[model samples]
Target: MLNKKQTNTIEVSSDIAQVIQDGQQLVAYMAKDGQVSLDPDLAQVMIDAKYKLQKKQWNAQDEAHFLHSYDQLAKAVAPVSMESIRAISRSDNDKPSQAEKAVAWYRRYTLVALICLLFVQVYYLFGHALAHDLKDLYESRNEWHLKLDSEEPNSKEFKQIQSKYEEVGQRLDANYNLLKVWNRIWLMGFSFGSEIPPYSQEKLNVELRRLERAQADANALDNLNLAQTRLTARLQLFENMLFAQSVLEVLQGYVLPLLYGLLGAFIFVLRDLLREIRAITFTTDSEIRYRLRLTLGALGGMIIGWFLNPQELSGLASLSPMAMAFLMGYNVDVLFAIMDQIIDKLRGAMAANDGSKGKSIQGSGNG
Candidate 1:
């Protein structure tokens, strides 16, 4: 039942507004007498606000009010540079200020996401292209096969082609033999046929044993043929063609979902990365952020894939691109909620560490 806030509006209660105002006044006063140092905590709050509010679209009045309200406070923060403060004040058109930062982030974040997705798409297209190119190259090479169990080939070229197919067929047949025991098990357990007679369990067990023995025989034959023919190279090429097609079907059908998954995960991770980067201090290490990004991205890929995976792409089962995009968007929002929780945990841990160290330092100095 945990809930996460997507926006940082904070309700801005009268008390908090007063706090911000007083903080602003304190910063301004401190700036005047060569005592320009700001309370780092107050500065950090403003910096946090900048990042938290960057997602929202603002207007000229909002930007102007923000600067007018806290420009001094903004100047106090460590990473909250003068350029950031000036950005708030430069234009009354809110689009160019905080709002524009959000837009720029959106654009850049999306571009990075699309790049990951494009890799998935490329994986499929690349396979198909390679298959076609290889097929053409083989044709041009005029590849020929030598026949072993030649059944009177119609012509030399036909015999070679037949030999190739026959070799593939033999491998397939051998593979089927290896799989026969599994098939027998399936048949005994659930084949579509008349009901088994009484004591069928014992009968099925016997049948399976018989199948196992048969499979061993087939495997022995396959080995003998393999040794005799030395057709491993040609057979491997044939197998590659079949393997590539099988792979194509999988990648082609699932590529869109994979794209969605990868992009969704990237979105989930990137926001956290930005937050972590913005939050970095002498205490916050980069390794933690990187690992955190990976963990969250992994979770996002699973969660997003679960909810919005492209299940079926043919006929009425197919999803429109807009729908897919929208679903991905919805998942991103959920991912953001998860990110907030992680950030909160990180902040809590960092705060505790600081408090414990502060007490230890004071105790040592007193001693």
Candidate 2:
């Protein structure tokens, strides 16, 4: 047992086996825990050991041994990483103070309330602008008072008034100056021009002449039928102008704001998802999931902006886009939680209703 050659041979084999075991442990730990440390000689020895292992036909026991080591490494590191991500400290694990809980709740609820207020404001501003536009249109049209309220339509006085109205209408149509008006509208955002005559002379002439002959009696002249014709003309003019102004208002109040919010939402979602993937899975590529989250966030923001009426809330409508952006960025999880609760309630209600219906049907059958 003490022969020099045999003793040296045994020592060399023991050293080789130690090197192999160390290399295996190092690689398994590094793979699972994302840590590495090596000197040049040690690194070389690990590489050589790994190469030798690869050449050998490993048994099930060999595979199990490596897997077990990996599992141990993962378990050791996972809690630390998770705790770091979640911001859970030793104090948090213990009983939280009432003051600490209150502060946390205050922060969350205050943010939610502000977001809701911002939504209200956006809708209010949009609605206020629209209402103002409509009001102006109504006042401007009413000032025309184009109806010839005089009793005798065939009289010289009535004819003279009618002729003057026609002249003004014709001049307005001919001198519309489309380029000038369009430039003004583009620059100023809105306008009401008399270029498009609210009432057509041909229709006015026919209605006036018809009413004059058919409703010639003193009482008939006072009847609302004559006034209805003038109202119709006014309505047509208002309809045309409202259509144009509505398009402008919608673009400014809804479309542009929604686009800005969407852009903000997309960026926020992408960044958050990328950070999550990096921290948790490190090697996972989540481009599709990121894009999907971005799209949903953007669309959700748009829907919130759409429902918030600016006119009703007036000054508050100014905050709509900002609120929507905030909602997309931070409040999305809270919103989803709230939505889940609502859905659950609705499902319960529906089930209850179905049960009631079934009971009623049974009672009816017995009766």
- Identify the candidate with maximal TM-score: 2
Q: Check candidate 1 and list the clashing pairs.
A: 59-94, 60-92, 60-94
Question: By TM-score, how accurate is candidate 1?
Answer: 0.30
Error of 2 at 295 (Å): 0.8
Residue ranges of candidate 1 with Cα displaced over 4 Å: 1-98, 128-230, 234-258, 261-316, 320-326, 330-367
In angstroms, the error of model 1 at 324 is 4.0
Evaluated against the true structure, the overall lDDT of model 2 is: 0.50
Q: Write the per-residue lDDT of candidate 2 for residues 58-91, one digit (tens) a residue.
A: 3344444544544453454553242232232225
After superposition, the stretches of candidate 2 with alpha carbons farther than 4 Å from their true spots are: 1-48, 51-240, 248-261, 270-284, 305-326, 365-367
TM-score of 2: 0.44
Q: What's each prediction's TM-score?
A: 0.30, 0.44
